[model samples]
Target: MAPKEEVWNPSVETVTPVITLSFYFYPTSTTGVVIQREGFAFSYSEEFEQSEWVAYSLSSLDFSNRNFNRPFFIEDPKVKSRSADWRNYKKSGYDKGHLCPAGDRKSSYKAFEETFYTSNISPQLHEFNDGVWNRLEQKVRYWAKKYDGLYVVTGGVLSDNLKSIGEENVAVPNYFYKILMTKDGKKMIGFLVPHEDSEKALYEFVMDVNTIEKMTGIDFFPKLPDAVENKMEKSNDYKEWSF
Candidate 1:
């Protein structure tokens, strides 16, 4: 039998210690229903009708130039509360933006297809999705190739006051964030970008993980040692990231 998965509580430590397939870099949950897929894992937010955060491991070997047919977005079967429907984005003037980008999972057809699950998507403006966000995704790929591998955690800053769309009322976030760390946890960087298109350099959006933690109430990389986590999360310096 599979090890029992722990349901984390944001208020206090309320989980049993059990080793699971989840990566050590996975973030803590604010909401419930943590879903682990073949390619990634995420915490589903029933209130917002989307994932609170998505995380996965990336490496040069994970990238393939193979062309695969794009799959239609569908509700994830693993979500106990049921993920939002893909139609929630249709005619809503927002794109069903991917949290675990399909490009990153192209090495395998199943991995790529898993990214289309609605649980791994968020409502995003088309321009923003195709513009700066796409640029950042490409940058992440480049860094993964350069660094050998990285652990990436990303998602929108979901809140109650944000605009909602479609019959399900999927919340559209005002900002999005991505945090990356080397496999050895020696280098870390975070970016917080406004939910819009801009020609600004990516480095200009750099932020510290500590600030993001406070905003999202998600404890990132909780498995790391306290001293290392504190030092890495407090630094916003991007000089080591090579832009």
Candidate 2:
């Protein structure tokens, strides 16, 4: 059978202000756009309405490996399940850490649980996710609270070579990345951090939306125009907006 077509439903916009700018939040994740103060603009994925568990089909984007070409469901569960190959990972002393925290997306419980998918996870040391990465995710939330709301996309990077752990297959990402846009749709900021823990790696770096596109091979904001992509790469001013 052909796959189910993803649909987006537009909702009212909510705007709130921060120190430098104001933000906007649409009730649903459907069609929305954000413009940054630095003059970069981006389109967001269609909001997953009716349910928080939106299936982002990896096949939809241009990202590298075909092995990762499957639909990923985002949900929030009380406890993350152990991977089939947990023993192998445990022997290596790594935990199936979540790149996108369940709490950050807790607009709803179901949405929160779906975020626990192993596909969306990476082999991370307990210290890194619990330490620096956790702090960063909190900062993003703080920014969201200060401003109206921020637009965000986060996930692990998968390398070309796929590895098998225990009985399940897993892919190691070269890096993990996240993109945040201010609410008013006027500012966009991108951050890339290595999968390993390092104090120096925590600092935020400037990124073009395309940088993520090139890495994930997924076209994040498919509804947005081409000009937004062009604008994001040229503007470095958004770097100053980082904390």
Candidate 3:
């Protein structure tokens, strides 16, 4: 199950890091390159035609409480491999899933629009996209509102020789992972959800950062002092985030 062909790139263009993150937290990738965007930073796996991870911060102020007209998904000119055509998703019976969800950027129209970039999306099962996955996103918003702010990194779990869709060969991941931590890094929680729809409580999917790193091979908060990173990554309690 060899990954698809991708040229080696040591780096990609610059974008600002979230408050809890520094350049050091950026995941290591040779085939998957990093790109910073208005609201998030992600490593693009051209091999899978999707992002390996997308990281961002959500603040109470990030929500304007305005109705935003959703926009069309468009190709990201910034992506050198060129982002997948939105057409690949047409009639594919999958949602053009967002890595950086548009709702999180409702603070500004432009911010919301920026999320429409194709590079920010992947194929997702419709039931999953609108079901438990959607509920998890809402929980993130609630946590951000409660704690004032949070740093989050999320993406699908990629494996070799996976199934793909459309003419572009976009990969469909079996599972998705999201890690949430407070601004001061007091508490951290992680979740792994199957790509298909599920009725189980979100808490059922809770995991430790250690497990996510092991599964994805991406160091989450490397910029934290070694001691702090070690302690935080080792904790897996979801009760601290009780809503």
Candidate 4:
């Protein structure tokens, strides 16, 4: 967690546009600070010292395009309160989990590097982060490849009186959720996994998006036609989504 001794090189790529996602799903009015980095968008939570949710779109082409080395984690100076330091995870039995995963943004070095910012991280149990959580992230990439493109929204369930760590009192969520959908809204699925390790099939954690919305208190895809949104959110069609 020591500061880098060498000069850090920032990417020259232009910042990514904030135009792709529909306003219906962003919740900018009620959500905390909204920032659009190279590969993803996020609603950061000052109270929890991490993002409440991170949203990004993945395309099939990104899978094969490029790769880069991971840089040292850095505090997100853009965060008004200043992000938690990486040193907080030392001997903490938790991993500094990336909300907008680096793998999803490998299309550009800048995109990949932005993910290392501290504001995008939350404390996660080592077993859970490496196990089912990792598997689900891989699945999202697979779906991105199959669908050509997909929209993903992921985050931990933050709430009152959670166990905390570090001087920041970073909240440790007992459960985390991920919701994904094809760009056209023809197909969608949601998964809610407890913040613990398990060896079960991924679908075992699948639930309707409505269930997820209720559980998280954040409206997802509010811009879609109500009829389409209602139906998609209410249905958990596992058969339609290939593993």
Which candidate number would show the highest lDDT if scored against the true structure?
1
* TM-score for all models, in order of appearance: 0.91, 0.59, 0.88, 0.88
Candidate 4, 1-243: lDDT as tens digits:
732232212222112342234333454314558876667778888888888888887776555557588899989987877888888877888999998788888767777888899988889999999999999999999998887677788999888888988877888999999999776567889999999999999999998989888877788776666787798899988999997
What C-alpha lDDT, on a 0 to 100 scale, does residue 213 get in candidate 4?
A: 84
| lDDT against true structure, model 2 | 0.45
Predictions in order: lDDT:
0.86, 0.45, 0.80, 0.79
The lDDT ranking, best first, is 1, 3, 4, 2
lDDT over C-alpha atoms for residue 107 of model 1: 66
Specify the highest-TM-score model's number: 1
lDDT of 3 by residue, 1-243 (tens): 833433222133122333223344456653557887667778888888888888888877666788988888998888898878899898988999998788888777877887898888888999999999999999998999898678888899988887888898999899999998776667788899989889999999998889989888888876666777788788777777875
lDDT string for model 1 (81-120, tens) is: 8999999888888999999999988768888999999999
Error of 3 at 169 (Å): 0.6
Query: Residue 125's C-alpha lDDT in candidate 3?
Result: 92
RMSD to truth, every model: 5.7, 12.4, 7.3, 8.9
What residue pairs clash in candidate 4, if any at all? none
Error of 1 at 131 (Å): 0.5
lDDT of 2 by residue, 1-243 (tens): 833433322233332212111122211222332222211122222121111112221111111123322234432222233223334354656666654454543333433444454433566667767776777777776666665556566655443563434334444444667766653446666666676666664444456667766765555555434575467544645544646
Task: Name the 10 consecutive residues with the lowest summed lDDT in model 4.
Answer: 6-15
